[model samples]
Target: MEDLVLNWDLGTGGLLLLAVAAVAVLLVLIMAFKVHAFLALMVTSIGTALAAGIPPNRLVEALGFGFNPTLGNVMLLVALGAMLGRMIEASGGAHVLSERMIQLFGERRAGLALSVASLLMGFPIFFDAGLVVMMPIIYAVARRVGGSFLSIALPSAVAFSAMHIFSPPHPGPVAASATVGADVGLVLVTGLVFALIIWGTVAPVASRLIGARIDVPVPDILGDEDEKTGFESRPKVSTIILLLLLPLVLILLNTALNTVASTTSDPDAFKATPWVAILRALGETPIALLITVFASMFVLGWGAGKSGTLVEKIADSALGPICSVVLVTGAGGMFGGVLRATGIGDAVAESLNGIGLPVIVAAFLISQIVRLAQGSATVALTTAASLMAGVVAAGDYNQMQVVALVMAMSAGSVGFSHVNDSGFWLVSRFFGMSMKQTLGSWTLIQGAMAIVGFVLSLILWAVASAL
Candidate 1:
């Protein structure tokens, strides 16, 4: 992959202030002080704008320019994702699947269900989105079958995390594939296989066994504060299953069609066929997502007999996580932009090169520092990846190795999530575990996940070198 060079001449001190200040302060406020990410993001962005020394009217312009586009582009997708998740939850789809899976796993083998759901859910949806959608199912199963939330929810989250960090179709690895000039389809296949293997070999099944001795504190994934008199009427198992798989099918089909089209030898034959053109159109990612969303609506609404009001309510419920994610992403984006603008990226690159550390190692370390200091995984991933993009542009590296590099960054981010990481608090708050218990379980879990992920990446790296 080609290294990215920052365009420094276009950036200025004021612009730098508006961008980095927002990112750094927002992260500090949330992770260090335990401030809510939503409020911290808003205030820090505003502070950044104000610090840039822009005129009041121009500051308003910057705010509008940055905020609206960020919200519109990212948040809309996030909203759709949230609604889909809620439908899966409230429509009884989640309950039915979890219930059935529990029976299949039996008490002796329930942790395996976490691995299964986590692997499937990671294909198209965000990790947190999968967690939000699947957590309730974990909790309900826990309450009904009798086990700590740790037994189910932790494994489920870990499974999803494996998919998120290691798998493709999730943003970082997907973007890394493009940045490194890899074939996307190959990465997708490879990532899924590795994700499933890691989740199986690494996830602590013994959490259930050891949990019996430890009195493992349970965390809630669904903010289901409501008391249930009886189980809500669930949508059919088939409908729930179909809706969940719909997005992935479209994406994979699109990828397959495009590969076939790319290999077409005859120009006349390629352009002449109406069927070929139609297949090309159908395979696009945005279109695939759109098709999945509309399909899910019908399956959950009409097929499942859910009312529009219920769907709307579930959508609103989905907003909390979506909003929290966007604010952090925007702040992170601004930070990346500023690092480029300020010439800090270039200086850092030169310094690393002088010290004889490879660019990938530098990128990995920078991201790790950010993650350790501030606990927002999204922020750590975005800013660090974007900054590393500069280094990626600076040197020629193997396309597949870039994927390995992304895994290193992801591994660095996962371990040692403490007071500063919002996920730490979210898990703590929802599950009602003390900070100590959270450190013991959530902290240990994250650290273990990262360690195992890094080791896997090293193995792949060695194999790539040998090849």
Candidate 2:
């Protein structure tokens, strides 16, 4: 869809105000009125488009402009990823992998072991899904190892949070990368690197310190009885590991080939080579994920003794839970399209330039504000990236710089989880922590993760600039 032709213009100041008011109204609807994010975003987008004087006839076109393109790139990846995760979770691969990690790490370092396992599992899994799958393992470890539940559980929870916030295939970073025109492959590589760095430095220390200070016992929310009863039938740990690594390896291969092609005398011709084309096609994120999902069904499903019908049902089941996530993401894109069509993005870019605010810093701050207001990292990330899409387009950023900017925004999105956030409640209830205890521990861990991630992004931005 083409940009809408404006009959009347809101000058920069007016456009900026419109943007602020739009965001404010969006926050109010989501927070105060408890409106669903999808509905809130739709209402705000339509209102903002009208308020900005978009021609009545072009309003629908303007909305679809952003929504369609974003969902086109994002929806397939999310759906495939969820299917892969469901297959692994349902096959008891998650449990078997966690048990193997504990054996290697030993009971003395069970917290670290669970954290490492969660990070690997978190690659294809959403935060909530991975957490729920691993809770039984986390609880069992806490019981056997006899430690503060926070010490055992917090690190693992943060590990999933780290991967979800920073990495690709997860809706938040994927949508943000798409909005800002960052390469998903590069985002994946950079996000994984930084997620590990931040998780390594922050999670264990913070979890142990907080766990030591406040001893919350593991709750019976997920009972310990028969925790390992069905593990004998699960896929081997090595098989599960390979399943998790398949997409990452394929995507990275694509990135590597693209890099090699870029250095050739005729980059276009290099990419057009028959073998290279075929390889790149396989390496595309969606295709890689699709291939992995099938591989998972065969390995985790049939190879593990599940019937073909059962495998089909497992994949089918994955789609229903993610429909809301898919729609909400599409709605966010619609909202972004309205901002771009109305020229609010351009106005904000010029305002940032005039105020001498660095785009990367501005990206983080804007994402943080939205995150603090609404408590959904995906919402915050998509909204902030949409707002900055114009600025990123106007700037002379290399791919690395753009990726760094996305990382910074993503870092901001994951910070400060509190009562308003569903994840906060999920953690509190699962661990049976009081409200105050959760505030002290989970919230603090998230804040630390965000700060460390942003700092690493700043360093990456500098490195990219220097290169």
Candidate 3:
């Protein structure tokens, strides 16, 4: 279902109070009381809904509205992406890629290479999924190079986080663009420019400064020891790279065609062409991933000389671990959804209009508020965009400015990931960092990236307006 259709009866003060209470209770449950994230989120959602005066009968509907859609969008990607990653890792492709990267970039630049690779892979994969897929390589590189886990891990994780937040085909910016009526092509283009600038300039610096202060031990979550089993039979680096790039190429082609088709004078011109339609379908995110998974089965499985049953077992193993990640993420979405159902985000966005800030700045602040209140960046993005849609319509922003606004909203959505965020836990568990260590590293990295992204977006907005 779409975000809750709410005609909020509560005034701004009441809604704000409820939102603060809900977030407080959620944090207390998870951080202080040590409750499982899913149960805590459910109880808090139900309590907050009642306190916010959502009718008792509609409470379940509201929870389901938030939970199911998030589960639907995320599960397929996470599951399939994990499967592909498992196959790659199990087949020793991760080792091959890391070794090749170290050779090409040398040891000093290996971390940079991994970050760049993650930036590319992040184009098609979600942040968590991309991080999972790259974990083996990060571990391999760290082991070979001999350094702090943060040195190798932070850059790659931050790269994925930046791309996921600031670019399209990752839900946040795409939904934000749609909500605010920004051109998706323009947003994608401008978002890419800003994303690269932000990640390239900011993430590495943060890795050196912040990551140096925090020490984290890399965990063997990806079954790295088993990688040696098929080391000699691993697929070539080119083959692994091809598998990784397949979805991105398809998705980009689809984006390019849709942009061209939308601009055509005759709307039906592209639709009349069967080949164009088919290509677009293939470019769809889910379809692109499905095709990539099947291709991987042949390339990484049979082509690599692994038996069919072995490949099946490998993929099966990938799913069991990610069940918590998927559920916690969905629960984070549920909390954000319940907040939306109460119209708290809307109230805050509406309040921002009289604050004398630029709309782009206002958009960023609103998104950050929603993000901090709830735990899901996607939820923060959509809720913030929904609230800003009316303001954006009235502002008459130019195309570039509109794109910048979308990026700003995206930046805000990813601003601060703390206790309530499933992503926080995922990073902590996967990288084997304590909660405090994660706060110092992953949380700091995301916060720094978000601030840098917003600043860059503001600069872009200024330049665009001046032109």
Candidate whose TM-score is highest: 3
Q: Which candidate, 1 or 2, has the higher lDDT?
A: 2
Sort every candidate by lDDT, greatest first. 3, 2, 1
Q: Name every residue pair that clashes in candidate 3.
A: none
Q: Report residue 420 deviation for candidate 1 (angstroms).
A: 9.2
Worst 10 residues of 3 by lDDT: 224-233
So what's the TM-score on candidate 3?
Answer: 0.86
Full-model lDDT for every candidate: 0.58, 0.76, 0.78
TM-score versus the correct structure, for each prediction: 0.66, 0.64, 0.86
Please report, as a residue range, the 10-residue window in candidate 1 with the lowest summed lDDT: 1-10
| Two-way TM-score contest, 1 vs 3, winner | 3
Q: Which of 1 and 2 is the better model by TM-score?
A: 1
Put down candidate 2 lDDT per residue, 367-417, tens digits, no spaces: 775666445678778878887898889889899999999999999998988
**Better structure of 1 and 3 per lDDT:** 3
Clashing pairs in 2: none
